[model samples]
Target: MGEGLDFAVKYPFSSAAKEILKSDGFSNITDEVVELAVNKIIDSLAGKSRKRIYISGAGEKEDLLAYVTARIILGYLRNRYITNKFAVNESKKVHSYLNEESGETVDRVAEELGIKTKVNDGMLLVPLPVFLKFTPRSPHYHLINRCITNGFVQIEKQEKKRMIEEAVRKHLERVPLVKKPPQKIISAAKKIINELPKQEIQATAELEDSHPPCIAELIDAVKKHQNLSHPARFCLAVYLIGIGLSDDKIIRFYSNLPDFSEKITRYQVEHARKRGYSVPSCSTIVSYGLCRANCGIRNPLNWHKGRRK
Candidate 1:
């Protein structure tokens, strides 16, 4: 199993690993087993294994196992670390905007921060987890950490506060160019300053009838004990909050889900409320196949304007 797993990691696109995994004894491989196998494979590839295991593609089962294992690991990695080109580029923009005074281009800053923003065609790839193999001890560790943690360079409260102070100090040291700093620097400073922690809002029960048709449909589905998809549930939660529904009321709405967990649901709803998350756009709703009514609008928030029934 160990040798086969190692082979899978080495030649992920091959079919040998799949054959081994699908064998009678191994056919019942659970997610836990696959995860363990993936970790082992990663360790072997990283040279962390006690003894190197040679993977020869000579045997049929060996080849099949290698392929299957590779696919599983790749899929897991893709889901965990892979993101679109737009997200990476957006992070680059944020990084560039924040460090403008440092006289460094976005690419240079990214390289200095050890952020790998590789774009091929329209796909953006960042080998985030692989960075763990090399010990990184740079002043930009926080920036790299953000790339890994948030999958983007979204300024968090603590970091934002630190950056704001640094910017202010820098400004104080320099002679005034005008009455204030350049608009670009001022905008960036304001952006960082606004990165405060989300505050909890008092939920109100008003705006039920004003809900967009899609949100109304989701609420009805939840009430009827129908299971909603993650995106659907998220949209509904955000819509509810946008329409002034309390966390408790949203919890009640989700109570009938087949897989409902009270603690988890409450936490998610409260988090959305506190963070002031808004409903997804009409296009997103349509992509989820949750948009039932035409509503003749681009935004879900506006769906209730003309039709309040």
Candidate 2:
């Protein structure tokens, strides 16, 4: 719990968040998640805490995505001040201690947020809650944080005692309705399409140029593979994004589909390749069969393995 506990915050504030939240209409789940995320950040930064935060998402997938995004962004802000320039002429003592404890990556994000490191004698620990819609072995549930619902956060011992006492004296305040989960996060994507000016989208894309080349490849692959019109493909794209595959690779794999009965086999192989999955694995073959059955359009190339009798 050393490093993991460190990632949890004394206050879990958002003054140092990297994600910007705005209202836009689109049907993608990710959009609404960004909104809930912003609220959480704002609340945490505003000096608010809940004794028991209950998050009931529509499904485990959405729940995990929202949770992970929140933690990554929150973690970044919390650590930004310690590593980055916080105060002019401040001693480098805190920075050195953090570096010695956590790796540079964690320290860097903290530095960006302007946090100073100090020892806490009595730190509150929170238990992360992640329910599994899929098996615990599944990557999505396994890698994501489950703590949004019933997790305790650390604060100065004195501050914690004061807050607990005040909470007991006064009824725990209910966060505004605005902080509640959206009617539908999927619908928010349409809002993004309607309101986000084309120029701004282009600007964001352009800004991503500095993002790793692998990500660009993954995006390309998704655009290409999306031609198959199978829900499995979209699901696979989501999985690939989780694994950090470049869009270009996704597009390249999609481009390789040929016309014929063997399309499924090829897809099975190609998708596995993109994921760095080995052939014949139970999950890989099962996914391939699902894709093959769903993609009835027939590949144009019609390539098959082995020789005909």
* Candidate number of the best lDDT: 1
| Model 1: per-residue Cα lDDT over 1-309, one tens digit each | 665554443323224434545553444444444434444434322223222234553343433443243334433333211111112222322433445434233333334334444554444334544233222222343343454433433333334323333332222122222334334333332332244222122223453465767877776666554446677888888877776677887777675563456799999999988888878888877866788888778878776565665
Segments of candidate 1 deviating more than 4 angstroms: 1-210, 307-309
TM-score: model 2 vs. ground truth? 0.19
Best by TM-score: 1
For candidate 1, the TM-score is: 0.33
The sequence of per-residue lDDT tens digits that candidate 2 reaches over residues 1-309 is: 223223322212222211211121223347666665444433333223332233432332333344334443433333221111111011122223334443344334343333222333444332232122111222332324332323433333333232222221111121122233344432332333344333111112322332222234333433332112233444444444444445554444444221112356356545656676422222442443333332222321111121122
- Model 2: residues with Cα > 4 Å off, grouped in runs: 1-130, 134-137, 140-194, 197-309
Model 2 worst lDDT run, 10 consecutive residues: 82-91
Candidate 2, residue 274: Cα displacement in angstroms equals 10
